[model samples]
Target: MSVFAVEYVYAADTEEGRDTHRAAHREWLKGFVNEGRLLASGPYADGSGALLLFTAGSEAALLEELKQDPFNMQNFVSGLRVTEWKPVTGAFADYA
Candidate 1:
């Protein structure tokens, strides 16, 4: 399996827009974490964006998972960036 960093940059306008879909969004994220696809996730203090760490078998797999986010489906993100990362030594070193 591989490890990846998936960032969901929320649109400030979308944050307000997200109020319409917050419940579904939370439910979707909970499912992903339970499934081991999401290693970590949280919002920026400014409430304008969020970061998501993913541990997937491949980049394609990660994209497939991101497609499942309710917020993404609702176009609540300003942008989404996915990057491959190598964890050399740390609590997450075993991730890759």
Candidate 2:
């Protein structure tokens, strides 16, 4: 599997929708966490977006999985970016 950095850009005026779906979103993420696919995830301090770290077989596979996210399904995300990363050191160095 490869490590991927997934970026989620929140759409403006969607705070209420995001709040309503937060539980479902976290539940969906828990499934991945249990499977060891999701390493870490959280919203930005500024609340403009979120960052998620995951391990997947490929970018295609990761995107496919992300398509099911409640945030995506609810259209709370204005943009999504997925980047394959090479973690050369620190907590994720082993992934490299």
Candidate 3:
């Protein structure tokens, strides 16, 4: 599996929508966490976006999984980027 850095850019004026769906979003994440696919995830302090680290067999597989995210399903995420990441050092370096 490869590690990926997933960046989610929230749509403008969607704070309320996010709040409404936050519980479902977290519930969805728990399944991945239990499966060891999600490494870490959190919103930016500025609330513009969020960063999520995940492990998947391929980018396509990862995207398929992300399509099910409550935020994405609700259109709260306006932009998304998935990049393969190699953690050369730090807590994630073991993935390297």
Candidate 4:
């Protein structure tokens, strides 16, 4: 599997929508964590976006998985940036 970093940018004036769906979003992520697909995930302190680390067979597979998120389905995401990541140090060095 390859490691990937995904950034989720929230749409302006969508905090209420995000809050309403937050629980379902988290619940969806929990399944990935249980399957060892998600390494870490959380929102930025400023609340502009969130970052998620994942392991998947390919970038396409990762994108497909991300499409399942409630946030994406609800159109709460204004923008998304996805990139393959190579972790060469710290706790993730082993994966490298």
Candidate 5:
């Protein structure tokens, strides 16, 4: 398994709109995390965006899974970046 980092940029108008879909969005994400597809994910605190760590065979596979998010479908995410990474010195490094 390889790690993929996904950063989501929120559109101003849709940023605040996330509340309306928060429940469903979390529900959609729960299955992925429970299955270990998602390692960790959360907002950046500044609220401009969020970060997600996924373990997948490739970036393209990760992208396809991300497309299923309720938030993404609603266009709450204005931009994104996906990169494969290596974690060698942290709790994440030992992730199964």
Candidate 6:
């Protein structure tokens, strides 16, 4: 499996839409966390975005899974960026 960093950027106007779907979004993420596909995830301190760390067999598979996120389905995401990550040190170093 490869680690990936997924960033979600939200516009100011999306707050209301995000709030409406927050419960479903978190619930979807909870399943991945329980299955160990999701390592870490949370909103940015500035409330403009969120970061999600995940492990998947391939980028295609990762994005396929991400399509299930309510935030994406509900169109609450203003921008989405996905990158394969290499952790050379710290807690995630083992995954490198």
For 40-65, candidate 1 gives per-residue lDDT tens digits of 88887888778877788889877887
Residue 90 accuracy (lDDT) in model 2: 92
**Cα error of candidate 2 at position 63, Å:** 0.6
Global Cα lDDT for candidate 1: 0.81
Runs in model 3 lying further than 4 Å from the true structure: none
Error of 1 at 19 (Å): 2.7
- What's the TM-score of every candidate structure? 0.85, 0.98, 0.97, 0.96, 0.92, 0.93
Per-residue lDDT of 1-96 in model 5, one digit per residue for the tens?
888889999878775579999898889878878988788999999999899988998888888888989999999999999988788888788753
The C-alpha local distance difference test score for the whole of candidate 2 amounts to: 0.95
Candidate 4 local accuracy as lDDT? 0.92
lDDT, candidate 1, residue 72? 89
lDDT by residue (19-69, candidate 6, tens digit) is 889999999999998998888999999999999999889999988988889
Question: Relative to the true structure, how large is the alpha-carbon lDDT of every model?
Answer: 0.81, 0.95, 0.96, 0.92, 0.87, 0.90
- The segments of candidate 5 whose C-alpha lies over 4 angstroms from its true place after superposition are none
- Model 1 off-target regions past 4 Å? none
Candidate 6 residues lying further than 4 Å off, grouped into runs, are none
For model 6, state the Cα shift of residue 80 in Å.
0.8
Q: Taking the candidates one at a time, how many backbone clashes does each contain?
A: 0, 0, 0, 0, 0, 0
The candidate scoring highest on lDDT is: 3
Positional deviation of 40 in candidate 1, in angstroms? 0.7
Question: Which is superior by TM-score, 2 or 6?
Answer: 2
- Lowest summed lDDT window (length 10), candidate 6: 87-96
Global CA lDDT of candidate 6, please? 0.90
